[model samples]
Target: MEHPHPMKDFLVRAADLPWVPQGSSNVWFKPLRISPATGSWVNLLKVAKSGVVNRHRHLAEVEGWVVQGHWHYLEHDWQAEPGAYVYEPPGDVHTLVADVDDPDHPMLTLFSIHGPIEYMDETGEVAYVETAETKLRRYHDYCREQGIAPHEIVF
Candidate 1:
């Protein structure tokens, strides 16, 4: 049995994607999908032990699934370990911190983020804003600098 029409889809192995640095926080992200039309992006984010992901507030909802190691928000008491699912509502500002003393395991999580994330300074001012477009640009820039052809991730 064959379908009448061919499937219109994009596919790429995760191993083929490059891990682009997410600023100077000892964090990196491998972009899986980036949709400018919906202002959403999916990425696998990796954080080194004792790394800080900055204080940020999402303009829309964000979802995450821990794949390895553990982490927690400075504003929250509970920790998210491997297999843990997390949902962050819009406008909730929090600082993400990787396990402080875990030398063996760094935190790795897959996240589906919608809209832009505003990184706030200590004075509560918006220092930077990251959006799907910006993420795509960063991925392209990183791949270009590394002399690696970037996989098609934007849709």
Candidate 2:
């Protein structure tokens, strides 16, 4: 009747989670879950303006669910709106862009990523890389700046 590992029970109001700038204007992310062992993570990505977010290739499969507004990849014709579930297979490369015609409401999506994302530039050069360790570092930095414990924000 009682759970042994209370910390394992994850529950938090989405609004209460702090959103950290993803080194880009109008782009923010709130990490939900992170697993160091598997290098996997779940995060909420928010984009407030219509523009190119990034061009990245995943080393492992990635999954996402649109929570609000819409977005799509420039390389793909399909669009993801609220309630849409998307899957990106390993080695998939695409440019993520947000549809922010409605400035009042931004696009938000929940993403579960299983490996590092290799960000590319317009020339298809590897500009940078983002992995679970980087995300964890960012999360810890954000929590430290906000005066909140890391355990309080991440599971």
Candidate 3:
């Protein structure tokens, strides 16, 4: 199937997306489409260089395209290099860390989705978990090292 956005120029410049949305850098992301409510989706990342993304799983079969640098998660440490694509099945829980040497290098990715992803809690209970706020606080130290503000609470 062919999907066309409202405007042909519905694209986000790498420079435009914030390094940290509202000063939270851990889960900073920008959607590619002009209006992100629709099904077609993409995200830009300015994640921490070294930290745990906590033990949470997703309902959406998440897919990623690495635009720059790399990262390591569980089962497999994905090298989100300049040009590479990685896919994670539903219920996959793991951590994420940017390349050690260079933290400023942002990860520009395109994440297509059918719906919002779900996260597993500490007891392995499946529920809706919004990672934005929690991821920020969880990796505050790492964010500080990178000069990005920390998340408000631990999710």
Taken over the whole model, the C-alpha lDDT of each candidate is 0.91, 0.89, 0.53
Ranking according to TM-score, highest score first: 1, 2, 3
lDDT of 1 by residue, 1-155 (tens): 98896556888689989889999757999999999989999999988767788899999999999999889999998999889999999998999998846656677899999899999999999999999999999999999999998898887
> Residue-wise lDDT of candidate 2 within 46-101, one digit each (tens)?
99999878899999999999999999998999999999999999999999999988
Judged by whole-model lDDT over C-alpha atoms, candidate 2 comes out at: 0.89
Instruction: Give the number of the best model, judged by lDDT.
Output: 1
**Full ranking by lDDT:** 1, 2, 3
Residue-wise C-alpha lDDT for candidate 3, range 1-155, written one tens digit per residue: 56674434333455543343523445565433322243333446656455444555665677777767667776573456767887878767765655645566654456554344555567767655544334333244456767754432221
Q: Which number leads on TM-score?
A: 1
Q: After superposition, how far is residue 56 of candidate 3 from its true place, in Å?
A: 3.1
How much does each candidate deviate from the true structure in C-alpha RMSD?
Answer: 3.1, 3.0, 8.1
TM-score per prediction, in order, is 0.91, 0.88, 0.59
Off by over 4 Å in 2: 1-7, 153-155
Pairs of colliding residues, candidate 3: 136-151, 137-151
